[model samples]
Target chain A: MNLAFTEIQETIRMVQMESLDIRTVTMGISLRDCIDSDFDSMNNKVYEKITSYAGQLRPVAEQVEKEYGIPIINKRISITPVAELLGHASKDQAVQLAKTLDKAARDLGVDFIGGYSALVHKGITKGDQTLLEALPEALSVTERVCASVSVATTRTGINMDAVKQMGEIIKEASELTKDANGIACAKLVVFCNPVEDNPFMAGAFHGTGEGEAVINVGVSGPGVVLNALKRHSDADLGEISEVIKRTVFKITRAGEMIGRVVAERLSLPFGIMDLSLAPTNAMNDSVAEILEEIGLERVGTHGTIAALALMNDAVKKGGAMASSYVGGLSGAFIPVSEDNGMIKGIEDGALSLSKLEAMTCVCSVGLDMIALTGDASASSLSGLIADEMAIGMINKKTTAVRVIPVPGKSEGEMVEFGGLLGRAPVMGVNPFSSEKLINRGGRIPAPLQALIN
Target chain B: MEQKRAVVSVVGKDQIGIIAKVTTCLSENKMNVLDISQTILQDFFTMMMIVDVSEAEDLAKLHDDLDKVSQELGLKIDIQLEDIFQTMHRI
Candidate 1:
């Protein structure tokens, strides 16, 4: 039966059963002109603009959820990367700017304010350099701010220097905040290809090419898809793909409807509908489980690569067919602690860092839920990040590293951050590193062959 | 000797004993499962069974028996005779 496509949420098969709804309705506000000689006034302007426009976001999202029986996951805001906002400012002033963002996000009730990002695929600008320097202090002081840096790309083989530097910076960020699995570092994303309209947290930012205002959506439903798959236990490959396509169509519809509403309500341009099956720490709702169901014994096994590629391709196909404009890194997620299956796989010797990297070549995000020992040296952690960065730079896909260096923990130990943060059993990492190799911090120019097919 | 193959596509809500019932039907009819794979499609259970039935006692009766099994198990069954199953997606 052709399900009548009405609301975007309904299109995505969103059955709002519990009190849970789509958590947030993020407003992407541009902070290009918020620069000032005095930091206080400028920060205040930035806060006022976000608070005033986005104050209505929660109420509207709730109203939509209530009216349509769909749950909106988050109500958030993305600004021009904080560095651009503080372009004309100094180092200390940048930290103060980050502080201002923290207070405003806390007061406004937005879970996280993204756009503390820098695009340095080719080279770092002056503002980007300043932002990079202030990261340790800015991240340390801020509670609700998120940051991202794109250091490499397919066109640009790898920014060995930036990748090496960020490895140190991330470890430093973790050192200051030991608890919550380095919650501050959790907010940082290292991108090879960062998109403009990703409505997800920690990476969402207003791109330079965007209009005055535009609405992008992040639709997630790993739980729903997994549940559906469970009920279709005997479907063949073709039949299974059909089922997935149908399910994703419903999920994509949900996003499209929500995005259309938010755009219309705020009088902003509606951007593309991003159909990523973003997984969380929920039980029975994991991308890894999907692989397991498809005959892979474990998530990080030899067969795991093919399994992930199949699922990722299938999900994108289904979601893309559902929505007119499907964008962003739409694929499966394989965070160790986030997906119970992945965690179990990691614990059971079914998954490994190398396998996870292979999977990330096809799936969404990279080196995520990778919890290193607090004793993991700065250069060692950098080596790990470099490996992941290498994947994205080669594949030409958007990849992010959310490495949590759990303090005072050894390998095989469990680290619990409670709800959503989930429980993670620490995995082992290579102690040895290429400090000599990584320390040679210069732009690794793009490979000429990368331009070819 | 004559060679017979069937493309068996199973689709419906997942229930217990699907594989047992379907495989039993094939086995009783002297059909050897050439290859079989299953996965869930949303809330539905789907499977494709490639069976070589050259040695079957009765082709028509086997089809009828499998149809009965399909009805009893609440599954949608499509049977494609040997030629197509051999040609499509053979690895």
Candidate 2:
């Protein structure tokens, strides 16, 4: 391969191993039309729409991945919540509708199906509660079903009732899927200030405001960024920043090209580009590998917070310069089970749930891949989620919790989601500090600290 | 009677651990690495090592084990059969 750079080669440089393109060109196919009391018609319409619109998506994405020689990891679909589609039906009916979606995704070879969800940030409506109540069974029965419950927002503060309810739902979810260590719970995400066009999951949803279909590309390049950082080992921090800025500019541009192409072909609007470092099961290219290169002996370590902070800031600085409409959670991620380096670290005694949470204080999300005991209390799980969610509220950044509570499992055991979900070694939780305070429920008021002076 | 030949290609950022880990895996697997050409481009360390596993019963096992080692050390390894490399890339 031509390694040297020339004036003409600058264009060619955008597509290389040191460059990571976005994982998916996810077309948010709105399921608003599928809303009906009759489950048959609604399910049929939803299934037909995604399979037809998304049939060509995989082939086109594969063509790009090969031609550009940059791996686009996942080809996924996000839609309106299944619960919303069954607004007119009973709660049990919505669960049936979600199974239909799971089947549709399986038929289409879409690996994971998101948007089996509810938004109870204000208060749980009958439909929202029904969806929430149906979540554990709905998520557990379906192979690829991913669920989300939104219980907080900056403008709306938080729904303490919803939070408390989710705590119970999570507990029940663990009981149902205990053998899988509540692996279904890993597919469930709780978000504060969640994004609509998120190309990542188990939290992505096709926001209500979107068109019938809009192609949103989530670009990733932690590997590419680490490769760039490798070039400047002897250089100072300022020089390092410049190196990352230049690298991120090219990576984001590659995503723009793919998104534009996919949108044009699908005859849909191009949505916002999520320039996040989404990692996969790939050996050397995962996000945890990037963190290890950041001088951490392992991913969940003492220096990880500082490393992720630099990565998060530099990625934005560079991506902002490259593209005008950079959206989504535009930061580095360290979801332990999703990444191989993290798995190895957990296996090697180099990572912990506490350290992962500490890193999330600076990075994206907190204790993301943690697997808890199935027997753990409802109030405790809520406390766990609330502790992480509070970080996002305080920092004014999007923080999410997608923990798997494994029934009959304890710390030091492993919950294997296999493949991309990987296997996460269960990390111990704090024994008893937050139980009383967490049970005492109300909206924790916004932090006065984040206010602009 | 033969040096069971295999090609190893490493593609990743230049880090201090690359050399130490690569050599260690090769030694532990009882393979003599022949003809090692290493270069650093920008920050990427690209190394091609021709390993001799003449004493081994299974070269595939060695390759797979070293693949894990390559990942732990944060490098990518491409293990090719000895005869395949000789026919292609006539440099």
| Deviation from native of the Cα of residue A279 in model 1, angstroms | 1.6
- Top DockQ model: 2
User: Per-residue CA lDDT of candidate 2, range A106-221, in tens?
Assistant: 88787777888887767777778778878889888888878888877665666676777788888888788877667778788888768877877788888887788878888887
RMSD of 1: 14.8
Question: Please, what are the lDDT tens digits per residue for candidate 1 over residues A1-453?
Answer: 111112212222334321223434567888777777677889889878777767766666665554343567677778887767666778887888788778878887777788888888778878888888888778878878888888888787677777877887888888778765666677788887778877776778877777666667777777777766777889887777777777776666656777777778877777777777666776566778877786677777778887677777888997777677886566666777667888888789877777787778888777776777788777777677677777777676778787878778889898875655577888767877678778877877666647786
Global fold similarity of model 2 (TM-score): 0.78
Docking quality of model 2: it rates as incorrect
| DockQ of structure 1 | 0.01
lDDT tens digits by residue: candidate 1, B1-91? 7656655667788988998999888888778887777777588776776678779766557657878998998887655553321211121
TM-score of each: 0.78, 0.78
lDDT, model 2, position B4: 59
Candidate 2 residue A121 C-alpha distance from true site, Å:
1.4
Chain A: TM-score in each model: 0.92, 0.90
